[model samples]
Target: MVSSFHVDARALALVGSHATCETEHVPETRRRVVAVVGPTAAGKTALSVALCQRIGGEVVNGDAVQLFRGMDIGSAKAEPAERAGVPHHLLDVLDVTQEANVAEFQRDARAAIDAVRSRGATPVLVGGSSLYVRAVLDPLDFPGTDPAVRARWSAELESRGPEALHAVLEERDPQAAAQILPSNGRRIVRALEVVELTGRPFTAAMPGYRSVYDDLVMIGLSVPRDVLDARIEKRVAQMWADGFVEEVRTLRAQGLERSMTASRALGYQQVLAYLRGEIGEHEAIAQTTAGTRKFARRQERMFRKDPRISWLDVDDHALVERAVALASSA
Candidate 1:
């Protein structure tokens, strides 16, 4: 990605000094970068579109799951009609069989942001994935992976199942084990890999409050837990009604089961379990709702720790107006 701005000694001398400029300057000529973040069903998409409409901004997707094509219904991707003519970037950049790497995503998202700004448009990064958002806007780095160690873990995962591997993680790194779900075999393996190579806990290398960019504006949508739960259940019902099962069925026929990344997505995983006769349709819907509620709680917990974000109630009537005011001030 290109630098957002260039600093020159001559310009610094004219402004007083580098220290003074760092303390009090926000160049009006610099392009704005804003992020809309929150839990699932908190109306982030609508809020982002409204912000873009007001500020002449373009949307840059920050969700990891929304990167894949043919995984739309489960990912809750923004339909073209819902985007309100705003040019959205990076919606379907990968196929279902492709694995998503955060390092690659950081590079791609930054390029998209630069492209948006090059056209004199604000880049509004919107999604619920905490790590993806941080990877774009924060100074986060992925640890190097050893192919031999990774292959060993992968073979163990294939033979013994995720639960068995999770047990191993619990013995080695309890804190990392607590954060990752037992069923998340991919993450569990990665965490163990990091522990072996770096000689440190996996959580120690995670992103903190250190941001890579200056003048970044983060707005978080806040909702009551009960209301958010109701919204998630309603959204899951709507997804099912929209033939999400059929969408997964189509992808399954095209090697979804062998696709490690796409197969582990929320709705698709549950529906796949139902299709395999591991669970019924009713059980699938119920489990999806329960899992979504849990995921929302985790999202809230994650975002609350970021001190840079300004939180607003999603139910407020003046949400858009307040967000516009915040962006204008930035």
Candidate 2:
């Protein structure tokens, strides 16, 4: 049986016809910025493409990992064909060695949105990166980084480990520490840097949920936990079958490990460990699956806190129709 997540021919036709009759008539000034957000493997990509087709929109990538070059399969970045002729921005725009800065992404994404609007197309932001998505849509201010402070935290993380630094974060800002994983040394270091630089709790630096844009439509794909877990396992299996390990091997030679951000990506980290003989291939794949499941849960929880999102079941047969209606009405 075909999964409901797949956009069938009939649905595409309906969306295409709707685009011609309705969305095409809407003025560019009135165009709404549509954001397709959800947990991993919840079919956000398919929905984003379909919605763009129905709304004369361009996709602005909101996923952090997809920004890096050569980190394709594991990021589940849409292939050119999968994009269905829609222009996609921000994918493969950075080298793996460079860390993804959410503050920079906020500026870039808003610029992309403006550029799309200038060309008379709506901007459709799609990804599972909750913070990146929020950075683009919300009025969030990122604290400036002090190189000395950041370097000190980085040194502390390297010497004492992520957990030790995370413990310090717990003492300084329990809310920030609770939100960040103990194993995520980079994020821990960043949080610590922010705390030290601002002389305030890291969590206090974050803004409340409020969008800068008046016309914004946030569509969140909702998948049941059991189904999402199964989908994550299947996705990891597919990644392995699609040369994910080889991709990691190729990137490893390209200095993926030297990258503070890319090296720690879910599958890449596990596969690197496997290549280093720290774990077996089977264990690597297993860990990737388990880690991705946990990450998806976290994504869902973060997105759930925002009341602006219009949640739709991923399995809904009229998913595209409903999404089109939401965007059109906006």
The best candidate by TM-score is 2
Where in model 2 is the C-alpha error above 4 Å? Answer: 1-30
Instruction: Write model 1 residue lDDT over 1-330, tens digit each, in one string.
Output: 222111123211111111111111323423889999999899999999888777767788888788777888998998877777776777766667677777777877887788777777678899897888998999878898999999999999999999999999999899888777787788899999999999998878776697776868999999999999999999999999999999999999888887677798888889999999999999999988998889889888889989999999998999998998777684
Q: How does residue 118 of candidate 1 score in lDDT?
A: 79
The TM-scores of all predictions, comma-separated, are 0.89, 0.91
Residue 4, model 1, lDDT: 14
lDDT of each: 0.82, 0.82
Please, what are the lDDT tens digits per residue for candidate 2 over residues 1-330?
A: 112112223212212122332344555424678899999999988898888877788788888898888999999988877777777777777776677777877887787788777777888999887778888988888988788888888898889998899999999999899788777888999998988888898778567778898888899999999999999999999999999999999999998998878998888989999999999999999999988998888889888998989999999999999998888883
Worst 10 residues of 2 by lDDT: 1-10
